[model samples]
Structure formats: structure tokens, C-alpha cells
Target: MFTGIVEELGSVVAVEDRGLDARVRVRGPLVTSDAHLGDSIAVDGVCLTVAELPGDGTFAADVMPESLRRTALGALRAGVPVNLERALAVGGRYGGHVVQGHVDGVGTILRRTPGERWDEVEIGLPATLARYVAEKGAIAVSGVSLTVTHVSDDAFGVSLIPTTLAHTTLGGLVVGDAVNLEVDVLAKYAERLLGAVAR
Candidate 1:
């Protein structure tokens, strides 16, 4: 599990394809300092296991086809920046909301409205995941947890402070850019429980 707090803005070093699976190497000194084989790292919100500690501030993880199809990682190329987050340690300070590093769906940036103190970004919402998103709710976008400032049937908006804009990759987002979205898991669980009760 993770807290959806991005630790570093890492870049893809290499991508080696192996038919249905691909090996990815990302360079992140902070996340790699204590990383070990089998450790979990959230890359752009997708939880990937560390297959090898390359000892050069980089780690390799094999991305299965299922993961490739479900997230934006598959389309990434060398030099592309990605949000990196280490798995939450036991008793660690919970800075952000609970994040499972599972991408529910991919969304596209529809527009960005600049404000005096912050920026408001509107993102296209997937129909299947739309019902789970609510105004003022927590949502993870590309591994950075943020609050939903506004929500519509077709899209949602998030306000990004200057700190988030400077520290994370979200600062460079533009219209038509794709992002991984993970809605609040608590909402999903509640829906399941209500459905069971109704039945």
C-alpha cells in the first residue's frame, strides 16, 4: 500500500520488451536508496515489484501485459518523467489518503485554468469510474493524492497548489495528456456493502 504521496519525479531509463511482458528501469535515488529486490514501488500510480536493484540509483521491474493495458506506463518511453512513491512503511506518517497503487482507469486532461495562487485542472472522467468520484473527495492522479474541487458527469476538477505544481509531474500537464486515476477505495467498499445489504 501507499499514501499517494509522490516521493520523486523519476525518469524512465530503459524499456526492454519481452513479448507480453516488459522490463522497465527507472532512476530515482531517493526511492532506490533503501529499495531491495521484491520491494514495491508505485510508478505513476501502478504498483510494481522491484525485480533487480541495479545499484545505480535505478531499479528494474517487469511490467506484465495486464498492467500495461490498464495504465499509462505502457506508452511511456525513455526519458519520460513518472511519479515515484515508495510503499508505505509500518507506522509511517500518513500524509495522503490510502492508495493501493491500482489504476482504476486512464483520464485525459481537458483543460487547465490558471489562478493567482493555484491552477485548476479539469480532467475527463471515465464513465465506469465516474459514479465513485464526488466533489470534495480524495482522488489520486498519477500517484499524487489531491482533493476533488468540482465534479460533473463528464469531468472533474482539482486545484493544484504551487508546491504540487513544482514538485510533481502534474505541473507540466497539458490538454490531451493522459493520466492514471484511482478513486477513493473507501467509496467503492461502501458501495459494495450497500449493494449487499440491498440484496
Candidate 2:
């Protein structure tokens, strides 16, 4: 489990494709500082296992075909920046909301409204995942946890503060870009329970 707190802004070091599977290498000194092989790391909100530690402040993870088709990680290439977060340690401070690093769906960047110190970004949501999002709810976009400022049937808005703008990959995002979206897990759980009760 992760809290969606970005510990490092790493870059893709390499992407080795093997038919349907991919091996990705990322340079994240902070996240890999105490990481061991098989540890879980959130690479742009995707839960990837640390398959190899090259001892060069970089770690390698294998991405399966399912992951590539479901999330945006398949499009990653060398030099692309990624948000990195190590799995939450026991008794660690919960800085952000619960983030599984499991992308529920991929969303598209629809618009960006720049403010004096912050930018409000609107992201188009998939219809199936829309019901799980709510205004003021926690959502993970590319592994960075953000609060939803506004919501509609097809989209939601989030304000990117100066710190976020300067620290995360979202800062360089443009319209038409794809992002991995994990809506509030609590909402999904509630819906599941409610459905069970109704049945």
C-alpha cells in the first residue's frame, strides 16, 4: 500500500520491450535507498515490483501486458519523468490518501487553467470510473494524490500548487495526454458493500 506521496521525481532510464512484456529501469535514488529486491514501488501510480537493483540509484521492474494495456506506463520511454513512491512503511505517516498504485482506468487531460500560483486541470474520466469520483475526494493521478476540486459526469478538476507544479511530472503535462487514475477506494468499497446488501 502507498499514500500517494511522491518521494522522488525520477526519470525513465530505459525501456526494454520483450513482445508483450516490458522491463523498465528508473532512476530514483530516494525510493531505492532502502529498497530490496521484490519490494513494491509506485512508478507513476502503478504498483511495480522491484525486480533488480542495479546499485546505480536505479531499479528495474517488469510490466506485464495487462498493465500496459490498462495504464499509461506502456507509453513511457527514456527521459520521461515519473513520480516515484515507495510503499508505506509500517507506522509511517499517512501524508496522502490511500493509493494502491493500481490504476483503475486511464484518463485524458482535457484542459488546463493557469492561475497566479496554481493551475487547475480538468481530466476526462472514463464512464465506468466516474461514479467513484466525488468533489473533495482523494484521487491518484499518475501516483500523485490530489483532491478533486470539482466534478462532472465526464470530468474532474484539480488544482496544482506551485510545489506540485515544480516537483511532479504533472507540471509538464499537456492536453491530450493520458494519465493513470485511481479514484477514491473507499467509494468503490462502499458501492460494493451497498450492492451486496441490496442483492
Candidate 3:
């Protein structure tokens, strides 16, 4: 589990394809400092196990085809930046929200409206996952926790402050770029319970 708080902005150093699976090497010195083999790391909101931990501030993880097909990680290229976070500890503070590091689906940046002190980024929401999103709710986008500033039937918007824009990979987002999205788990559970009760 994670808190959807980005620890570092990491770069993809290399990607090696191995038939059904691919190995990814990411450079994130802060997250790698205490990382060990088998440790979990959240890469762009997807929980990946550490396959190898090299001391050179880089680690390798294997990505199966299913995860690749579901996430934006498959489109990653060398030098592409990604949000990185270490797994939450047993009693660590929840700086953001409860994040399973599980990507529900991928979304695309539809447009960006710059404000005086912040920017409002509108993203296209997938129809299947749209029901779980609500205005003022929390959503994890590319592993960074952000509040939903507005929501429509097929889209949602979030305001990004200067600090968020400067510290996370979201700062590099361009129109039409794909991003991994994880809706609030509580909302999903509530929907399930209410549906079951109504039946």
C-alpha cells in the first residue's frame, strides 16, 4: 500500500523486453536508498516489486503483459519521468489518501487552463470508472494524490499548485498525454454495497 505521495521524480533509464514480460530500470536515488529485493515500489501509481536493487541509485522491476496493457507504463521511453513512492510503513502518516498503488485505468489529459497561482487540468475519464469519481474526491493520477476540482460525465479537473507542478511528473504532462488513474477505494466499496443492498 501507498499514500499516493510522490517521493521522487524518477527517470526511466532502460526498458528490456522479454517476450511476455518486460524489465524496467528506473533511477530514483531517494526511493532506492533503502530499497531491497522484493520490496514494493509505486511507479506511476502501479505497485511493482523490486526484482533487483543495484547500489547505483537504480532498481529493476518486471512488468507483466497484463499490467502493461492496462497502464501507461508500456508507452514509457528512455528519459521519461515518472512519479515514484515507497510502500507505506505499518504506522506511517497518511499524508495523502489510502492508495493501493493499483491503477484502475488510464486517462488522457484533455486540456489545461492556467490560473494565476495554479493550473486546472481537465482529464478524460473512462466510462467504466466514471461512476466512482466525485467532485472534491481524491484521485491518484500517475501516483500523485490530487483532489477533484470538478467532474463531468466524461471528464474531471484538478487544480495543481506550483509545488505539485514542480515536484511531480505531472509537471511535464502535455495535452493528450496518457496518465494512470486510481479512484478512491472507499467510493468503489460504497457503490458495490449500495448496489447489492438495492437488489
In terms of TM-score, which candidate is stronger, 1 or 3?
1
Best-to-worst order by lDDT is 2, 1, 3
Compare the candidates by TM-score and give the number of the best one: 2
Best by lDDT: 2
TM-score of each: 0.98, 0.98, 0.97
Model 3, 54: alpha-carbon shift in Å?
Answer: 1.4
lDDT of 1 at 156: 96
Q: How many residue pairs clash per model?
A: 0, 0, 0
Mind giving the per-residue lDDT tens digits that candidate 3 earns over 7-119? 99999999998887899999999999998999999999999999998799999999999899889989988899999999998988889998998789999999998889788
Candidate 3, residue 113: the lDDT equals 85
Q: Give per-residue CA lDDT, model 1, range 93-198, as digits (tens).
A: 8999989998999999999999997899999978889899999999999999999998989799999999899988899999999999999999999999999999
Model 2's TM-score against the true structure:
0.98
> Could you give me the TM-score of model 1 versus the true structure?
0.98
Q: In what order do the candidates fall by TM-score, top score first?
A: 2, 1, 3
**Clashing residue pairs in candidate 2 (N, C-alpha, C atoms within 3 angstroms):** none
